[model samples]
Target: MEPEQQPNNSVVVVMVPLTAQSHLNKLLQFAKIISSRGVPVYYMGSTMHNRQAKDRVHGWDPSTISNIHFHDCQLQLPQVITPHHDLYFSKMFPLHLLPILIQLREPLSSLLRSLSATARRVVVVHDSLMSFAAEEASLISNVEAYYCFHCVSVFALLYLQWEAFGKPIDQGLQGGDIIPRDLPRVSFEGCFPEDFSEYAAQNIQWSMLDVGNIYNSCYAIEGRFLDLMAQHQSDKMLWAIGPTNPVAFDSSAGVHHKCLEWLDKQPQSSVVYVSFGTTTSLSDAQIATDGLDICNDEVIKQRFIWVLRDATDGLDICNDEVIKAQLPNGFEERTKRVGMIVREWAPQLQILAHSSTGGFLSHCGWNSCMESLSMGVPIAAWPMHSDQPRNTMLVTEVLKVGLVVLKSLI
Candidate 1:
């Protein structure tokens, strides 16, 4: 049945996601779920980002869902200028996205005030990194703001500990640091850049003012960490509503993705799926590792599908030039039957759900972790940066469902 054409507005939600692909994709899935439940959702972002999110969604078309409205904010920002020197890919991504917070402040506030006139309550669910953009929600009448964390509970717990109590020294944590001795010690070794401290502090301070916090996680895997987080923030409510992406794509919808067709030809439990999320890209040297070039005589025989993203823009699809430049010489021809390389943007859920998919070689991004776990696929956790190192620990140490490929950046 087709949903109603117009919103009646008992309660309205506004989703503000960071412009990164992983963040944008997960939040849109959450918006689709909310709209399906009869709540109207207004997804606000720059024109380019809004188009990217919609174009990149799989299985279903969000445009067909009338309740989910896409609002394109007009911003005259210039094209993102890439740095010539090497900065960690994860940190480099936020350098492009964080400026949007300052630009969005006034526009979001105006939208909230306008929505308040018609709706009884307006809920603003902004990305955890985007708190500064939604700060004005506190001043607007009938508007309530909540921080939506795309990472897991364990990472959040440790990140909050680090933000609250500085990096621990040889002298040990001073003052009232409430870190659990049992958990992995907080380390910024492969985490956020030093300049990001002020932004992290802003998010931490904003979290304190919000009434509730939301995570893309569930109690099944991170129940202990979630409970520990609740103890620390007794005044605020914590909700673990996750596995936000569809567990299974609707077969009845008749969507035929090409990757699934290839997987169908492989034997059960034969293929290892490889993807490193959106923002993390390997250095050229890292991409040339012997294990990746299945042509190497030393590596074990296996069938695999690798999603190699464009090095220039992690979210952009890799063109013929990128694939030709990045892959080892004749690597594609030597392993044609045993391997498949998707340049960018594979239907990850569909691939993970395939019977032939035995394991996932992933970057331990929280959304990737949740999707793999939901599909009963074990991860080979190769963490890159940000909260990924802690998320890697959650997968390998706590859940024991996966093994770590590398603990940190080489």
Candidate 2:
């Protein structure tokens, strides 16, 4: 390692996001926001993720966005052989991440030393899931680490702490079970698995104990919960500088432009844009009963553009046979003139920002929630799993900017 380079009046922020699209989107947006203010950002991720990040940055002018840099830290791991692929990847991620961080320390220190004397501080910002690795690496590298909660709310973080340290709550409580006063409006049945909760609580506790925290929410939306957390954990620094929608870095490609053009043709405030974020998948039965039934409605069918992304299973949802089989008989032909069904990823932010977009039908993921709100579009929340149900409450009850739809209805 090199001698400590202590400069003044400049900041070099190192950001490490979990190798997932939603997580990367939030972190990259934050990186852009900070870099725009003259700070330099060193974004670390895998080769593929770095490529995606670079592509997102390509939309911005190089002269204005020149401070953001990408670093590839690809991991070497054996082929996974598990049915629970996401779980397997999550478990294996830190093993790969730690080694990369170890290798990065000396070079990062050298880069800091090479900077002008005004470059004073080096802060490492990491996803909450990588708390363990980041905490350890920051200690070794002598950089300040801040954990970014990219997905869940600050209230969820407090609930995790309460679950871990406070009086033990029943893990198998039903949906209507009353939550303790200290916790947020969350249902036990809607919570994640017990094992997942345990893991999250452990890591979140580590983050709270060892590092500062960053939340991807603004004070207007979650100020009460943020205040509660700050009061409870007075020793640490917590910042809520978000609703971090990367509107400035959105791609202006032909495909995206085509989507905008289609929206432009529609009447203002007439279209309802529907998407379930990136990870959630609709079952065949759910697709037939829920999707078809909703589109079959006379009013909605005319002004809806549903984005049915088949990302989880890699299924070809765009195929005619696949669409016909999944939807009700003669459904597509009947709604051909009225509605549009996009079988892959759509430009969600762009669509939301369009004048014709009246509302959003979303799975209540934090990123989707932020994007919808940022665009001033109302939400029709249909939460599925993880922290979504709580997010739905935030949207419908707290913010009063959206409605909650029962899962059975959609």
Model 1 lDDT tens row, 24-63:
8888988998899988988888777788888777657887
Runs in model 1 deviating more than 4 A are: 1-9, 81-93, 145-147, 166-186, 252-255, 290-298, 311-325
Residue 223 lDDT (model 2)? 80
lDDT for 174 (candidate 1): 35
Q: What is each predicted model's overall lDDT from 0 to 1?
A: 0.71, 0.62
Clashes of each: 0, 0
lDDT of 1 at 171: 24
So what's the TM-score on candidate 2? 0.76
Clashing pairs in 1: none
Candidate 2 lDDT, 1-410, residue by residue in tens: 12234356666777767655677777887888888887778777655556655444323433356677776654442332222322322331223223343354444444443443345556778788656545544443345455555457765555555455644433312322223444354444425545555565666655653566788887877787787777667887788988776544333442345556778789999888888765565666766666666566554555788887543321122233332225667766777666777865576777887789999988888888888888899999887766677777778776789998665221
In candidate 2, clashing pairs total 0
Q: Return the top candidate by TM-score.
A: 1
